[model samples]
Target: MTLAKGPLFLLVLTALALTSCQSDDKPPQPRFTSDASGSQVGKASQREGQYFIEFRSRYALTYGHTYAVFGRLNKAGGMINPQVAGLAPASADAAPYVLGHFIPVPATTGATDGDLEEAYRSASWRILLTEAEYNKTVAFIRQLQAKSKLWQATVDNCNNFVGEIAGSMGYKTPSIWLRPQEFITKLREMNT
Candidate 1:
């Protein structure tokens, strides 16, 4: 080769060699982190006094009370007029049935971040799917669990485990396992 081209060719080869030798393995560290006050770091908390909302307002995602609100609505013949959420009785009648709700965020004011928070607040649950959306939520949770240090701590059930984790993000636990259908049924019973 030429005199100047020799050094350039060697540099390129060396870079390629180094890149090829790099490992794909991730370093060991906890997937979740916290702050000085024992609160989770990053955006792991949710704002209080707001309902979970998707683009169409048909899908609501919530953990404790907000989820209860949805249940209340559904049981009331598919609508709930909550005083806190500023929802009117008429609003529920017009909107489609809420679907695929999640309680990923904590119900704390100004708190941010919960893996499931935003999706709960802003997903399209009205579109029917062959599979249960909660199943997908559970799968996503498993992925999160894999990334966490508490791998040994099993999520024996979806609602229970999700509630426990949500507490870490700053939410109160509900007294039930709370699958979508059950939630709807519970709400209906309460209203009647």
Candidate 2:
């Protein structure tokens, strides 16, 4: 095999092994990480003008996706134009998503079309932020968006993306390699 193909071949083999292995021995039952039941999507304080940033996970075909939602709550405890952002391989084709497992692919660290939808949501951890704190965090996320330019399943995937944001905010983050469901749950447990 050519030198270049040698690395690619090994990567494919490794990705296959990783994909075949289960995240844990846990049951296949649907693990719901949020109990908000759609009335709300995450836990937050009741006071108005309380900003919140939620680290969230949602189901996908394979490992799933992790993202962040940040916004100010109205008097009724509803989010006002909640913003969503995450890192994912930039493509609509399955080839890139699958290829991304073995090598870094172009990434988009901004909104995905379905990020705000509740349909696939599996987990969330919300932190209430004061106005000043909210501004700081939002600015940091924007910086992340600008600097984050690649996604690889093993190295800097979605879980790792969210973990970076959480860790920056002084929250304890679990292993970035965990499946999204487990990662968010562990994040909540470690903090609360």
Best by TM-score: 2
- Name the top lDDT candidate: 2
lDDT of 2 at 39: 27
Task: List candidate 1 stretches off by more than 4 Å.
Answer: 1-144, 147-155, 181-192
> In lDDT terms, how accurate is model 1?
0.28
Q: Write model 1 residue lDDT over 70-163, tens digit each, in one string.
A: 1112322232342111111112321211211111211221112221343333111211111343234334444444543321101222334334
Clashing pairs in 1: 43-112, 43-113, 44-113, 45-112, 45-113, 53-121, 73-79, 73-80, 75-188
lDDT of 2 by residue, 90-172 (tens): 99788988888777899998777667777777777767766777888888899999999999887888888898888777777
Location of the lowest summed lDDT over 10 successive residues in candidate 1: 102-111
**TM-score of model 1 vs. true structure:** 0.19
lDDT of each: 0.28, 0.75
